[model samples]
Target chain A: MTALEKKFVSFSVAVAVLFGVPQTVSAMHIMEGYLPPAYCVAWGAVCLPFLAVGIITMRRLVRQQRKTMLLLAMAGAFVFVISSLKIPSVTGSCSHMTGTGLGAILFGVPVTTILGVIVLLFQALLLAHGGLTTLGANTCSMAIAGPLLTWGLYQIGKKLRVPRLPLIFLASMLGDLFTYCVTSLQLALAYPSAQGGVGASMTEFLLVFAPTQLPLAVIEGLLTMLVIMGLETYAKTELHELREGRRGLFHDAE
Target chain B: MTRNKKIVVVSLLIVVLLIAGPLLALKGASFGGSDDAGSVKVEEITGGEAEPWATPVLEQLIGGELPGEVESLFFCLQTALGVGVLAFGFGYLVARKKYGGDRSGTAGDKEKNS
Candidate 1:
């Protein structure tokens, strides 16, 4: 494919992935029984390695910059705290993003996974965010999908020679939206509507989650972009020094 | 204090804050632990409650802006997942040490080579 074709194709895929899918898949907890039993089991199975890799990476990296890791963990804690304050969206339905871009950007995927998992776990135990049985599926949706896709986007953006700001923005946007998409897909598969039709529930799920998710993704993207830009411009030297010079627990380059 | 000492102390403080801060807030905010029926009555009408005093702690943990119920679920789940991850690490470490296998590389390496 030509360069232009590749870019278009990339952009189109990103758009479709972000927009075409139902918002439920793209945004919410996507309750457990929404997918087929087999699908949930399979997705949960697929998630095991991501969690494992995330843990090991955290272990190794946490040693390199204990201070940074602790700071980041504190940040993760903050994310959890702020996340608890909810806003009403639907009458009985509401949604929130993990705001994981910061964690993912600073500490990388594995650390983000650990952070996401911790956040979700507490949510389950304390606040009943998602159900106990659905924890695996929820984890795969937010912890894995958002950060992994964000990381992938980061790679692609880097490869395309995109600037850091736009790259981080795109990554954050894609990550945020892809998470909702996966969630919508899971919901569609699990709690299919009784329209006696093909993909009816999934269609509904998409419709509901789309409007909310689309704007939310853009907002998250902008926020992530701004935060990353600030960090890069203001603390470029300090962050670089910490990343390169310090032998701490959270080092990814090592 | 020396730079190393500062780092160590600050690091400890961060860790303590991350862990203890949450526990304390959760403790202090425990409606179960309080005779704050007036607060509960207010929360019932408002759909949620807020402790002005706990704002700083909550802000310290999650961020400045608060999320809605769904998002709150998302955050709570996020923290739970993080705990699971740390627990898994301890489990793996213990298992590795006990089993004494050469699983020294990482799950990522295994995925890559496979």
Candidate 2:
């Protein structure tokens, strides 16, 4: 390898070591076959409309501006990296960030939906972290619900004239938290509590996820802010176009 | 490092601490997966009637579960592929800035003319 390539490889290794060392066998997604066939089909059906819209939006954006393809790939990559890091938490349980916030902030909800489904699909097929049967339910919670919240928060924050960095942090962090909330709800719906019905079951699942996810949300937010900062510094022109609504992804961008 | 770089580094250190501090202080906490916890809770809630009814396709093909090492390998490969693409995007953008010399204006002009 050339000197630059060597340096890049070493840097990547250092990153892998830094994040990968603390990992345990903690496959935290609603694992394969965890949901019943009926619930699985229901969730999968729910995703079809949103995914259709997402694909349409993505296609329009790519046709309008080819540069968006690069940013889209980067956003997808961010999701992959962030989601794979199953960080340990104070609850003595481990969970991972959804990493959908950055994309939601940059490209809005529809594009994020597409990015999320692709990543979830890979995890299901390759790593067996999530299963194909459960992909629809998982996609609904992690991709659609999470990014929707993030995009909404970002748009609202912008309207309120919130500072950029903290806004990014809150939107990203809350998006991660909200993904788990939706997951808990899905679980609760699938397996309602006999004693108190779906509410009690949902609360139980939420409490189980909260302690681990709270810290993870904060970490995801910070990491997302750092990435945005890096992009603002280096990819100024591209971000400017994206933010300007030239790509027509964000409502406020116009 | 520049001031901005230092700030980024320190923030990263903070992130590291946030992750490690819990693992260190918890002292023998199983660090179990919440997904598993959720499953166990479901079983308890349903009086052990709610077992997962399907197996992963790969596991079905192999007639067994994937080994932990292989699972980690797949996860690493996923992360590596993502990081590689992300790096390429950033590198392309940076290189464009260096060589293309502020072409956003021209691109916009071209769009307007078209």
Candidate 3:
């Protein structure tokens, strides 16, 4: 309605369009029924507490800044679009950036985890993007583990006074790569190698996914940086307010 | 160049690579979902006697795997719902903030714009 609101809407559209274009977004997920029932339940359990924390954090953020709700919703949409955009690389290895690291950088690990899980669930149940049985493993790799690692590295980078843009790029890329590593490890564990056991199986799975994932990680890093720059230019005030405390979800609100 | 322009340029470049890089770099790429590939690999490695430890409830309910077109439809619907939820939430937040919802909030956003 207001001029500022219109401005926010337009800029948000720009950001969304960056991801909205229908590319060959490989639904690069561990397909449905890939994981055993026990694994699914265990992974689901692993995600529960994280989601609980994420909910509380989001609540605090909303209370702190009503605009946070808008930002988060937009953020969730962005993460969903970006992560889901697939490139058809790698013959058999479904390669796409896990799309979590950048979200983690913007909102921290916990919040990103919530978005990742929500998207993963919809992708699995509705679109068959991934299997329901392996939602836990997928969530763990793409949401929890990857984001935490990315945010941790980002925090370290901030402490070291690294340049902001480069640090973000590197951190997010590492996060993307980390997701694949965990995915490979999960698969390896599920089906240990008869020859070399977990280690060999891990190596094989890693090799299988590596070629596609590595390049995607680099592209993800660049794209994340670009998106951050756009947000900073268009949404500077929000960004400043957001990183004010900078400790974690708890700090941002306080 | 302006920051916004630079961002647009960089983003477009990334987009080009994301779509085209795969076509150029990867040959024999089925571009298939990893699940199918991973499952096949598992079967091969495990001596072709492998069985999935579980089946998705939805798959069972639907009587089998969904047709590809149906799967795409669901994905589109999910995306539409997600975008709708996000847009509504953003609008609501801005509206709430304008209505003096936050502690010190006001139409400060409007004043700046005016």
For every model shown, what is its TM-score relative to the native structure? 0.55, 0.86, 0.79
Question: Least lDDT summed over 10 consecutive residues: which range in candidate 2 chain B?
Answer: B100-109
Cα RMSD for candidate 1? 15.8
lDDT of 2 at B24: 98
User: Predictions ranked by lDDT, top down?
Assistant: 2, 3, 1
Candidate 3 Cα errors over 4 Å, as ranges? A1-28, A90-94, A249-254, B24-29, B78-114
Question: How are the candidates ranked when ordered by DockQ, highest leading?
Answer: 2, 3, 1
DockQ of each: 0.04, 0.54, 0.29
Give the alpha carbon lDDT tens digit for every residue of A113-204 in model 2.
78998999888887777889999788878988888888888888989999998899899999989989888888887788999998898898
Predicted model with the maximum DockQ: 2
Alpha-carbon shift of residue A41 in model 1 (angstroms): 4.1
lDDT (Cα, 0-100) at B34 in candidate 3: 53
Ordered list by TM-score, greatest first: 2, 3, 1
lDDT of each: 0.52, 0.80, 0.69
The fraction of reference interface contacts (C-alpha pairs within 8 A across chains A and B) present in each candidate is 0.03, 0.77, 0.45
lDDT of 3 by residue, B65-89 (tens): 8888887677566557656765675
**Model 1: residues >4 Å from true position, as ranges?**
A1-27, A31-41, A88-93, A193-198, A233-238, A241-254, B1-114
| Model 2: CA > 4 A from native | A1-28, A246-254, B1-7, B98-100, B103-114
